[model samples]
Target: MRWQKSDVDKYVSAKEYIDTLIIPLIDFQMDQDLENNAFQNEVLTILSNELEKELTGRIMLAPSYYYIKTFDKDQEIVRLNHWVENVKKQPFKHIFLLSFDPAWKKSEQALDASFVWIPKIQSGDIGSKEMQHTIREQVKQIGELIRSYW
Candidate 1:
């Protein structure tokens, strides 16, 4: 099913740092009202719904990361490791780290999770061939990774 960070709010803490999706938007572009918690929840809803339709029950869409950027990589790894270890003790075979920020490529170390890349859409760069190819490639890579699980 499609999933989102807010959907897992009950499982996580209530803190400003618990937000994961808006930082990339703010870091890459102007800080618009879209960064508000309500707006972020809306985006998460839309994305989660779309993913639910796309993946169905074949893959359980775990919640998005709390925050895409971390002040300390080791701490981030430790937190993810805790979550992963919990899931590992369950029936899950793997976890996919869905992220649009390229910075995650660096912070993902020590986390036992696969990844789904979402290309960054900078101002004036959304529809460019570069973005298109990058997004397509990411989609292909995510698909391949998921298929490998079977």
Candidate 2:
């Protein structure tokens, strides 16, 4: 299920069978390299969408949470947990926070949600065959990691 009208309607009814929530944490790097940051943002969104599509039966992909680059991770924890609280009413048992930002790795223990951090890819042509292949492989591994929790 996804954060859409019809899918969410179904989720409202069949909530028991779908117990996982996948949250994509998007970081907007306010640096000179806007192109690279844009590429990462696009791929991360695509990755999260692909994961949701592949595991549609059991996972709900929430809207990506976009935040500025300067916010402190510790402060973000409170905000992140608050978001988790609202969604928890849906009774999702396993909440996973997926990000390319390395900062999340350090704050995983403090978060109520499980954090999966992937290394940031260097700036590249997002549409190139090589990049697409790399994304496919990475998402496959990420799917397996998510499955391990189930």
Candidate 3:
């Protein structure tokens, strides 16, 4: 649910997100140079295409989530409800989260939709074809479940 700032700072506001410490490594990539966003956009496009093909359209993406240093339950509820309403107005059937951390489970109410937890490869090493196939099958199984429920 959270985006590495380096992944979205150009498209979104920094105040509304979680800052990953590792983004420092990509800090240079966030420059105001035109090529920066272009490069980022290309990666996003490829990733989006890969995800779309893998999930077969069962997945729904949300704006990134930020941790509140001083949490406000009411404000959080309002924001989440708004997001839910916005998505419901879209062409989506179900919403899911590809989260490496379980804490993101709290956002389940944000979209008022079903969810799936996709595993992460923190090593940045996605392993072999077998591993990729396993992840694909998991996503496909989730897609089938979403279709069955919706």
Cα-based lDDT for every prediction: 0.48, 0.89, 0.41
- Please list the residue runs of candidate 1 whose C-alpha ends up more than 4 Å from where it truly belongs after superposition: 2-45, 68-70, 123-141
* Top-down TM-score ranking: 2, 1, 3
Candidate 2 has its poorest 10 consecutive residues by lDDT at 118-127
Candidate 2 or 3, higher TM-score?
2
Predicted structure 2: lDDT: 0.89
Q: Where is model 3 more than 4 Å wrong at Cα?
A: 1-51, 54-77, 91-93, 106-111, 122-124
lDDT of 2 by residue, 1-150 (tens): 889999999998898999999999998977997988898899999888888888899999999998887888888889999999998887999999999988888877888999999888787787899988888888899899989999
lDDT by residue (tens digit), candidate 1, 31-108:
444454433433433444444444443555555556434356577668767777776554456566665555657655
Instruction: Give the least accurate 10-residue stretch of model 3, judged by summed lDDT.
Output: 19-28
Candidate 3: TM-score?
0.45
Candidate 2, pairs of clashing residues: none
**lDDT winner:** 2
- CA deviation > 4 Å runs, candidate 2: none
Report the C-alpha lDDT of model 3 over 26-120, residue by residue, as the tens digit: 11123455564344333333333345455432332344434342355456547655655565554334444333333445655653544344444
Give per-model CA RMSD: 9.3, 1.2, 12.3
